[model samples]
Target: MRKLALSDEILLKIEKPARYIGNEVNSVIKDKSKVDIRFVMCFPDVYEIGMSHLGIQILYDMFNRREDVWCERVYSPWIDLDKIMREEKLPLFALESQDPIKEFDFLGITIQYEMCYTNILQILDLSGMALKACERKEEDPIVIGGGPCTYNPEPLAEFFDLFYIGEGETVYDELLDTYKENRKAGGTKKDFLEKAAGIEGIYVPSLYTVTYKEDGTIDTFAPSSSHAPAVIKKQVVMDVTDTYYPESPVVPFIKATQDRVVLEIQRGCIRGCRFCQAGMIYRPTRERNVEKLKAYARNMLKSTGHEEISLSSLSSSDYSQLEELVTFLIEEFKEKGINISLPSLRIDAFSLDVMGKVQDIRKSSLTFAPEAGSQRMRNVINKGLTEEDIINGAGQAFEGGWSKVKLYFMLGLPTETKEDMKEIAVLADKVARRYYEIPKEQRNGKCQITASSSFFIPKPFTPFQWARMYTNEEYIARAAIVKHAFQDQLNRKSLKYNWHDAEVTVLEGVFARGDRRTGKVIEEAYRLGCLYDSWTETFDNDKWMQAFENTGIDIGFYNLRERSLDEKFPWDFIDTGVTKEFLIQEWKRAMNGEVTPNCRQRCSGCGVAKWKGGVCVESKN
Candidate 1:
């Protein structure tokens, strides 16, 4: 293990020092002598943001629970620190013990998003390891990745040695245990990965060869050897109640994305919103028992002393036992000054009742995403909620004494019209009227209504996989129509309007569904000062536009152009265990204005059944 030199200290002064320092109360530490396998969990971003993620924490806690495996944390250095490392010829090291990353048995990098692809390469270069798996020697660590972005890892295929397709809870241990057993007999990295490819949900890209046609489609993907599954099914944990998760997560010194205690009450969503990839990929919702969840919350509050506790999930309002859980937490922690916050609350009058239990006063504005303005448009997107739902939801909240409400909607969805844009303004006007109509005692004066709209980006493994996104010109025009509609009203000042840059949304669409060629564009964008595009202040559209030109790839091909069912998607090679037929069926239902029942009530029969062996909660009836 190399020590941090004098130069490293100087570099930390300019960059954020907290990202490099690795002492947290809940972090994993192990004796090097006793561990057979050492796993380095790497997040391809700065440490502050990465440490804030609950997914990384869960894996860290799960693996470290085993005495045979020791897990440590590693994050990519900021550009300023990278320069110093390059000048001083220093290798990237783990924060827990300053040990070089290459020394570990498993280097598990999380590919949360496509934007972090270059950072993975930079980490490899800094760690004194080969950037590509084929270039590495037998002694080099086995590089692997997991997370939401792993579903379409083709663009990043050149970098990662293997991709863990789905949930890490079951798959991670299988890989670790396999490595330990094989290494005892003195096998090489190739030998272990070859055997690992046999395990479910593990994709060893090197063992299979991908050939592209001259027309820019996949000609064929043939397995070079007998070490692969024809279709790798993603691992699913049927019961989340028994899952191992940390009750008290590490509380950060500086406020991170989630600034309070979070309890993951559920794993998946039952609502089949056509454009939602999360709902499609993370099929078959699993809930934690109310009693177990309440106990966990009490333990976390006692250990970390966090003032606010959040009931986290795809949709907290949809949880069957949410009322009971909230009652228990409020009863137990109200005296302790703990406030409950729900992230994805459905907009309804009943929601207001649940929210009232947590916040003493609704000081902050309430937020709800109607997704589309018109009933017809909402049906096309399969939002499963009508305009009446929004009207009732807002009316309820205002009556409950909420002065302000923030409404979220998307522009440029499939089959959307300018009339749909106008309807947004009409809906806002109606909500404002409803707000003022509340009697004087219950009413809060000067009702604030904020409507934020964004261009919809079609994602993979969803019903919109073949759908085309809006071009820049189209988005701007639609946005203007929606903005003016609100202004056209005589009392428009009562309503506020905000929208994101359409160009950024388009670029996100490109990277979300792009192929290996997309990597060049990312590299060029980073080379031209596009770091932290995730943040609003630093995103440069011109740099990204120029990068696309330099790479000779048309952005429209990925974002604006619609694909046919016959056309090969860049992510076709990887299997997420959900069938194409299921997604296509949902797409048909979206067009017919039909709503699929929630997974808890009826099985939509999305193809997780291939691996689940039985129907998802929806289909049994």
Candidate 2:
């Protein structure tokens, strides 16, 4: 049994004691002296949440497969444990060995969202590492940041020594080999970083200098070191089927957010939603073979003893072999009493038929993310979902005994109007009315349509990247339009409406499109106790405002200003396989309400095919 640093007294006091305890089943534990690299994979969130992420598990399995590296997992201790650790002066430790992360060779963090910026700082602080990369000594671990957020990592550049741009599995071996070589040669951290930068997809923030014009727009982002490339291209895994996956993932003693076996059916999305960041960043959809997925799912379920299995993908319905995969699962597991958890399938006739066979319709609410309320607004966002489609889908679902429906929309989108906002209520009412059209004998229960709208955040590498966003007040007013419209409905009692925090949305926009100068504001916010900004209770708008005020940065300049066609963004230095020219063209098309066909329908030529293979093969589904 591994010795725990925290005593039983402290563990018992916290909300989830299992979170702090290590020695979970299937967790990797190796001799520290035998491995060439001692790596700590840090997810800037609670354990249950981090343990649920498939990316971390896949990377953990891949890294551990190499005898040269021993990677352990660490999550930000929950607020309760955070207080206990701070008061007790206990350094953050990895779950596997209960060893201080400060003693590790590298700390790789996954920045999945902009709201988790404060937590990144908190992770560094708790681990006894310097908050800023430049302030760290030669003995400190090389702090690396990755994931979707690294495409525009300038705002937090000062904190991370290196940013891995693109897919996790692409260039890790080369980078790790370089680190090993440097260590064998007794090279310093800087020397290793310089050599690592030479590898593709590695962005050394210190090697580049960013300068801005008087207007606060990025003027020159040039490489200062020879190792730094003029333009760092993102790495893509050409063949995802060949990638490593953890059939026997580390199982937590306590339940996680996604405890079921997650079978990743595919990578990337085909639908070109102009406002979406993931659709753009994860360009050119690629899927696993249906047979392979069945094999993996069964293997994982057997290995982990999970009773349920979920198929994961950006758009599950878009998978060419979705029906085949679902049938396979239903046939293989129905007798065994294993549950088949479906992804966000379209509420179409086919999906409804499939759901009837696999799911309890009363227990599962049909979900549809129209993105925008009105058809015109939907066209602007390139949602490709029409009012007729929604109404028809809802009607078919209701006929199939699904009484509960969840409608997802976005407020404050570009070109949004009062009429457009009101249409959200109209759509929800239409769904309720459609439910009533079904015979009472066939109905599952009373119709319940839950509509949720999140504030539109213009993110980098999207058609809306150059678009202007709304203030918190403006966003609320737009949401109020929908709220009032819903209240006016005769079936208002059946409808429930919810909106996300506008203040948090505005802050996310500021950080998403911000430059290197924004790093100071983030640091100051962390200093003012702004950790876990993603959590509603911990997010203090006043402290964030104060940080912006203290840093002398106009939040509006980053969030509200509309950039010109020729303007350069801080993230322009990194080529994410998508050309700026293409994005600009798409933006213009969106302004004209022109819908671009999906990757399968017709090739829009967004330029992700440069790597060759995958879904960009013209004839690929």
Report the lDDT tens digits of candidate 2 across residue range 239-284: 7788888988988889999998999998889888998899988876
Clashing pairs in 1: 602-618, 603-618, 603-619
lDDT tens digits, residue span 261-283, model 1? 88999978878788888988888
State residue 363's C-alpha deviation in candidate 2, in Å: 2.2
Q: TM-score of predicted model 1? A: 0.94
Q: Which candidate achieves the best TM-score against the true structure?
A: 2
Candidate 2: residue 287 lDDT (0-100): 82
lDDT of each: 0.80, 0.89
